[model samples]
Target: MASKVIHALYNDDDILMLAVKKVKAAKHHIEEVYCPFPVHGLDKAMGLAPTRIAITAFIYGCIGLAVATVMMNFIMIQDWPQDIGGKPSFSYLENMPAFVPIMFELTVFFAAHLMVITFYMRSKLWPFKQAENPDVRTTDDLFLMEIEIHDNEEELLALLADTGAVEINISEK
Candidate 1:
């Protein structure tokens, strides 16, 4: 059986919340939600788990720090010893202050750049990729609720109507 998406449109946040509450109370499966702007507590209302992007970013930042430390230590101490400006570079522990700038830069660079890449990759977004937005209006002034249905379109439509949906349409995919 092919999956169907019923799109419900809401103009205001209150109406949207009410609709979401009612749909959730009815135990109907909501496939996705589209909003013009982020709605506070919507993720909790939908029972969605928190994103792990922060943890991923932290790990990537640590990796960057490790890379920067090893590279600097090898270059300054082991590989090519440079005694620039009369600052001894026998070991990073000897003059930890000197490596602070490079460490900070690498940490920021790795965390920001790699976290963004991870987020995009996990979301299946890439360069030159067209986003799959069903309704253009949903990006502006509309909130959409996509409900997946196995059968009983009439029942779903009635539920949506009872929830005060401004507009509703069935998606064929």
Candidate 2:
């Protein structure tokens, strides 16, 4: 069976934020909000759970740091050691300063790359994926809020209109 959804369009992000807070306070379930650009504090206004991507980035950085450490130790200390600028070549501890740049680069590289991949996976976004935003204008200049309909369509529409929505639509999907 198809489920009914109400799409309310807001011309401005500030208005959208206010509408989200109002809808949430009225106990309506908001499926999502789509906008041309990110709306600051909209997630909190919509009462969304906080994301943990930062923690994952930290873990990825640690992994990268470890890999760089081990790889540098083996290549410089065991595989092939060479003297440069009279620096000690026999001990990794002695040559630690020389490896600092590589370690920092690799740590940032892994964290950024892995974090992007993880975000893509979590969001189910990939190349050639079908667009899911209901309104094309949402990608241009509009903000859309999707609400599930229970039984009070009229009341919902009226409330959405009162919240400064420029356009409101309903569909079953």
* CA deviation > 4 Å runs, candidate 2: none
lDDT of 2: 0.94
Tens digits of per-residue lDDT for model 2 on 1-173? 88999999999999999999999888898999999998889888888899999999999999999999999999989999888898878888999988999999999999999999999999999999999989999999999999989999999999999999999999986
* TM of each candidate vs. truth: 0.93, 0.96
lDDT values for all models: 0.88, 0.94
Model 1 alpha-carbon miss at residue 154, Å: 2.3
Task: Write model 1 residue lDDT over 70-118, tens digit each, in one string.
Answer: 9988888899988889988777798678889999999999999999899
Global fold similarity of model 1 (TM-score): 0.93
- Which candidate has the highest TM-score of all? 2
Query: Candidate 1 — number of clashing residue pairs?
Result: 0
